[model samples]
Target: MSSSDIFIGEVIGTAVLILLGGGVCAAVTLKHSKARNAGWLAITFGWGFAVLTGAYLAGGVSGAHLNPAVTVGLAIEGGTEWGKVPLYLFSQLLGAMIGAVLVWITYYGQFQAHLTDREIVGGPGAQDTVKAVPNSEPGPVLGIFSTGPEIRNVAQNLATEIIATVVLVLAILTQGLNAEGNGLGVLGGLITALVVVGIGLSLGGPTGYAINPVRDLGPRIVHAVLPLPNKGGSDWSYAWIPVAGPLIGGAIAGGLYNIAFA
Candidate 1:
């Protein structure tokens, strides 16, 4: 694909990925929504379908490497050109941010209702206090935008993200590669989606299984900047792990692929 196609496809694909993926989080987490409290299984299946939808929409145009982790892994594995990596990353991040904003818009009323609830915020003006990430736990809605650790330990959280991401990137490297050695062809997309669901079901408890760097960082940035009252802090303190751990995991998966499967 050409540069423009790659850029557009990635932007669209990633936006849809985050929109649907984050949409589920919002549906299940935010108050007043029908899907609220739908639980982890709902989120995993929602995200899986999100992947399938995005991959299908962009597969023809850009091969739909919607995640930077996938892009990096493919580059290291020699399936994608290093020269295109920056474009892919930028587009994906941009798309993810757009998607996150869309989620906020789609559930604007729900967000307002949830955050302003005295019980949810603990009091009338608690959002002001929750704005500082270093001072205390994250805002109530942070999980809608990005992942966080249940235990808040750096080592364990980082390890969970890295391991989950390795499984993700490695699966794409091996199973998502079609006969042409390019994108996740039709069936591959479905299988990859299922793999994501599997990752979420089996490994999401630790750190929400962020496996993709931009998937976490982009939305977190939006979470910080968006004008939502009582939205609380973006949790910047734990941000780097999702970014670094996924990249490390992608690189490790690529190297491991070369060692054993290349």
Candidate 2:
């Protein structure tokens, strides 16, 4: 495929990925939505479906490497060319940002209602008995857009991201290797989608299973820049964990694949 094809495919595919994925988070978290408080099962399946749809739509053109970590892993695994890496990353990030904006637009009323109502959002006993770090000026709704660790231990959080992402990228890399070197084939999208759901169900509790740098960072950037009422800090301080861990995990998966599976 041409460079334009790759760019357009990734942008559109990733935008849909984030729209449905982030949209599900909004559905579950935001107030006054029908799916509000629908719980973790909904989110895991929602994200899996998001991956399925996006990959099926974009795989032909760009191999549907929606996540930068996946792209890097593929490149390291020799499935993707190094020259094309930058284009993929840029397109994915841009698409993620666009998708997040769409989510806000779709759930504008819910966000406004949720952010404005403090009692409903962070009630009297929101923190529980645990001693929470003091945030003098907290933003309320950033969680809808990005992931945050339930427990804020930097090393643990980073390790969680790395471990989860390794599983993700490794599953992706091993999609369809056969004596024929068939390589993922049509079943790749569906299988990888299920893998994503599994990761979310099992590993998401720790660091929200970001596994994808652009998926977390792009939306976080949107949350920081957009003028949402009481949309708390972007948590830039914890941002690097998601980005760095997934990247490191992807690279590790690449090396492992070359060593054991290639």
Give me the runs in candidate 2 sitting further than 4 Å from their true place: 121-138, 177-184
Alpha-carbon deviation at 65 in model 1, angstroms: 0.8
Model 1, stretches more than 4 Å misplaced? 124-136, 176-181
lDDT of 1 at 17: 99
lDDT per residue (tens digit) for residues 1-262 in model 1: 6889998999999999999999999999998999999999999999999999999988998889899888888888888889899999999999999999999999999998887777887765655553422324578899999999889899999999889999999998987464333588888899899999999999999899999999999999999888776677788999999999999999999889889898
Best by lDDT: 1
What's the C-alpha lDDT at position 211 in model 1? Answer: 92
**Per-model TM against the reference:** 0.94, 0.91
lDDT for predicted candidate 1 compared with the true structure: 0.89
Clashes of each: 0, 3
On the 0 to 100 scale, the lDDT of residue 27 in model 2 is 96
Q: Model 2 residue 253 lDDT?
A: 93
In TM-score terms, which candidate is top? 1
